[model samples]
Target: MSANTLRAECATPGTQHVETGHRVATRSAVLRYPSLTTTVPKEFVHRASVAEVMLTDWERREDHRFVVTAQWPRSHSFFTTANGCHDPLIAAETLRQAGSLLAHAEYGVPLGHHFLMWDLSLTVLPEHLSVGDAPAALDIDVVCSDIKTRRGSLAGFRYATVMRRAGHVVATGGASFTCVAPHVYQRLRAHRLSGAGAQLPLTAPTAPQDVGRVSPTDVVLSPIGQRDRWQLRVDTRHPVLFEHPVDHIPGMMLLEAARQATVATLGEGVTPLSVIAEFSRYAELDAPCVIEARRLPRTEHEEAVEVTGHQDGEQVVRSTVTAAASAG
Candidate 1:
């Protein structure tokens, strides 16, 4: 492959299975070619890939662990907080991009294919919920062993990632993904609806600060008659969220809506430190998806928020967002 084309896998799955984390150290026999640099072109990447967390330098020293490096740029969608800490989502995306890209390089994951986030749980240790802009020098060691194949064409796997600065723990989380190749994705459902431009019934939008978005247009859902509830605004033209059309509501849009709700309820200054979300069904664009967020008690230094979306009376999206106490 050319320099920018692809990097084929050359390493073998070594026999040495060492305990890299708190979990038992049984390595996965199914996993092959443990490490690889990401080769997915920037354009093919679903998200705006320019400032994303794609892996560069990669090396696998053990069956359960691979050491790789990724960076979040200043132009990152979620900018650094005033305290100079990177968003927890950045760390989450780091784990995601690393694994997906590695899968593409090592397992011949098709270029047009993409992995959908089914379940994700990430937590920041500190009370402030801020993982400082740990530079590119810091390498995130990922341990992956849980890989299961579906009956048809799907594959499910979970990854455990840890981020640190100067050997100090910054954040940790484990997330599960469902792989959806291009052919499989196209077969699922059709993209967009009949009236793409018709206006939907919606309450006036609250300010960007109310939803934690830097700009009002960034907010995907608008307020409803009920408090702490919103009607998902289906706009295919959204540059960042909806770069292209899709059959269902994009997972990132749900995450962003939940994040905005959590921040809106928490009010200003608080930042989303960690979030755990589960997608049960597709929030179709043809109908209205009612979003509701409930604030949990201040259990830890950081407060908690629960957001859910209902479509046709069935729960489609659910998220538990934890925000650190606002910095002064």
Candidate 2:
């Protein structure tokens, strides 16, 4: 078969014509060609937003390694920021996406939530690539080095991601992920699926420390509604509970918990859309703080909420969240 025909057959999932069982799945298929040479639509390119840099048409050899290319658009929103990265969550999700691709390709099963990310070590290199800069393209590569399993469960996988502009490395990071069972994976999986991913179930809110409480707070607040705004206070004793020895709470976990708390305080049913947050200062494990959310304008599709985290009357993190109305 011609090279084009071979690539086409390989890109098609569940196609009988492909000899190797290792077919490219939905997310991984983007990496099959050198710089997006495949016939996928341009819309997928746009939807990826900041990830367009890493979803190139780079050729993949039989060794399971791939290279993708992207250009840092000068007009992109992240260019003017301190880190110059729009969202840390996107970085985390990119690692997760890479891990999912590796897991499916190596183990023949989709990755799920049974495993959580315990740690991530990231280094944004000094090199900065601007949109209008002479070198317009960036190189992104992901590779898995070690995978461990225990008791028939996915213990974790260690992988590295490198981001480069014009052949120069701009950012690099390593991630670790634990795996869970297929059923548990399904619930989390449903969120990404169509129709199912539309809205999260609005149940009574629970605090991180409420597990041991004989009577937990059952107040189900609407995080978004006609109300003007919502406010939250995240007070904790010195030596905050579950504070990691690393001096920083896991960014993703803490952000999610804070989002939940904001939603609970709003007293209006709201489904979280996206949050762009920055970790300005570290909160003392024992230090108590306040997180406040103010409702902003609303569009037909989403409502905007502004959030801020403060400790000892000083701001630590600030975020603006967009959420959809709850299904109920």
**TM-score: which candidate is best?**
1
Poorly placed runs, candidate 2 (over 4 Å): 1-54, 57-93, 111-115, 133-136, 150-155, 184-328
Please give, for residues 129-206, the per-residue lDDT of candidate 2 as tens digits: 323434245566867667677666556677777876657766676666666676765665554433332222333334
Residue-level lDDT tens digits of model 1 in 187-277:
6643443345344443445677777666666777687667898888767666656656565677777877888788778897667778898
Top candidate when judged by lDDT against the true structure: 1
- Superposed model 1: Cα runs more than 4 Å off: 1-40, 43-53, 77-80, 125-137, 150-154, 190-204, 325-328
Give one clash count per candidate, in the order shown.
0, 22
Error of 1 at 137 (Å): 4.4
- How far off is residue 178 in model 1, in Å? 2.1
Worst 10 residues of 1 by lDDT: 189-198
Poorest 10 consecutive residues of model 2 by lDDT? 235-244
Distance (Å) between predicted and true CA of 71, model 1?
0.9
Each model's lDDT comes to: 0.67, 0.45
TM-score of each: 0.74, 0.40
